[model samples]
Target: MRHLAIDVGTHRFIARLEEEAAPRTCAAFLEMLPFSNQAIHSRWSGEAVWVPLGDFQTGLDYENHTSHPSRGDVLLHPGGLSETEILFAYGSSRFASKVGQLAGNHFLTVVEGADKLMDMGRTVLWKGAQWIRFTDLGER
Candidate 1:
């Protein structure tokens, strides 16, 4: 049994495995979206408001914006998952990256303010299990 913590930021995604005690970097995860150029916006039709892309009924509502087919029982798509799983995994990866970047930036900002403190070191620090390396489909 292993616990995995996925911290998503605006620029990158950080994955930390509780059992391994490591952190991994994933950049360009969001760019792999199938509809990257497609923007979802609120549209005013002749009579009604139209929501672009519509609402997703099934699967986890990732980032509260997109949805994909569920991948069995695993919420986090592990390696060797099904095709749907892979898709969701990549989606999750991208979301993670966005979140990581945002968090990392926030953390950096806070750390910068705490420069006078000696105990607080660098802006980025991973204190957990080992890191499990995984290839991002975005890069593929």
Candidate 2:
């Protein structure tokens, strides 16, 4: 299985890449390893933090997509109805954009630090945008 080490502000987490379910998305994402960006509380998606990737493209369409993701679910929005983005759900989430409801490719799922997701979300919500990074852990 493939794994990724995620750093959300002061918190850390390990997430499993859902390669089997989202092969193209995973491949495209892995190519962008060691990704870093600012994550802020989502204005449309509840209980989630997102890193906006304006006009970014994965060169792929949605795979294993979902608008409602459980806690710890990581989604990549294929730019179309809205700008591209990566969303991390710490609680209930209904993915959307200014246009309306949308779905994202569920490429990563947090396995470690699941309990801290809420705290991470809260920090981004109240303290403003937080620096987040995704480090490829390779397959293990």
Candidate 3:
């Protein structure tokens, strides 16, 4: 199982790669490690935050996709009906956009620091966009 260190705003978390369930998406995502972007509270997807990539290509289709994601489930939207983006579910979430409902590749799942998910969501929701970074936690 591969792990990733996610630091968003002032909060930190650890997530496990869902390689078995979403191999292609996981592989592509891993190739882009040490990634940083701005995350804003979702206007359509409830209790979640997203980093809109806007046409960023992953060269892959949906794998292990879902519209409803539990808290701490991280999804990658492979750009089609809507723009490419990363969804971080902090609580109940039904992934969607201005265009309508959509599903995304469930590539990562937070394993540690989940207790702070709601706080992270609230912070982004009230305080506005926050900087989010993803780092590969190699060989551990």
Candidate 4:
């Protein structure tokens, strides 16, 4: 398990990458650590937040993807039909793109402070886009 820190506005969350389950995805994501982007409240995906993963693509590597994601499943969707993005599901969520129902590689999932998911969702929803940072915990 590779630990990561997700800081959104004032609220912070901790998650773990399922390296064993998604080796390629995890490795790619880890290499891009300490990236900050806009975390916006997803409209189509119920109770979720998302951020673009920059110009990175995994090209279907470790694409153990899924459309139905449980609460707190961090997914990495490689840009194919859509742009590469990270899905941070707080509650019931359906991973999708503008095209339609799409699956993503389940890379990370919240481990610590899971109880704060509801609050995190509420903050992003009401407060609009917030600064979000994804990084390896040990780095800083």
Model 1 Cα lDDT, one tens digit per residue, 1-140: 22222221111233222122111111112222222221111111111111122232223212212222111101222212121121212211221221121111100011111222111111112221212223222211
The TM-score of candidate 3 is 0.98
**Number of colliding residue pairs in each model:** 22, 0, 0, 0
- For candidate 1, the 10 contiguous residues with the lowest summed lDDT are 102-111
After the best TM-score superposition of candidate 3, give how far the Cα of residue 28 lies from its true spot, in angstroms. Answer: 0.3
Tens-place lDDT per residue, model 2, 1-140, is 98999999999999999999999999999999889999999999999999999998778787999999999999999888889999999999999988999899999999999999999999999999999999998887
Where is model 4 more than 4 Å wrong at Cα?
53-56, 59-62, 138-140
Estimate the TM-score for candidate 4.
0.90
lDDT of 3 by residue, 1-140 (tens): 78999999999999999999999998898899889999999999999999999988889898999999999999999999999999999999999999999999999999999999999999999999999999999646
Q: In candidate 4, residue 90 scores what lDDT?
A: 87
- lDDT (0 to 1) per candidate: 0.19, 0.94, 0.95, 0.82
lDDT computed for candidate 1: 0.19
Report the Cα lDDT for candidate 4: 0.82
* Tens-digit per-residue lDDT, 1-140, candidate 4: 45899888888888887877888888887777778899999878888998866667566553678888888788988877777888889899998767898788998888887898888889999989989898788522
Sort the candidates on lDDT, descending order. 3, 2, 4, 1
Question: Which stretches of model 1 miss by more than 4 angstroms?
Answer: 1-33, 36-51, 61-137
lDDT of 3: 0.95
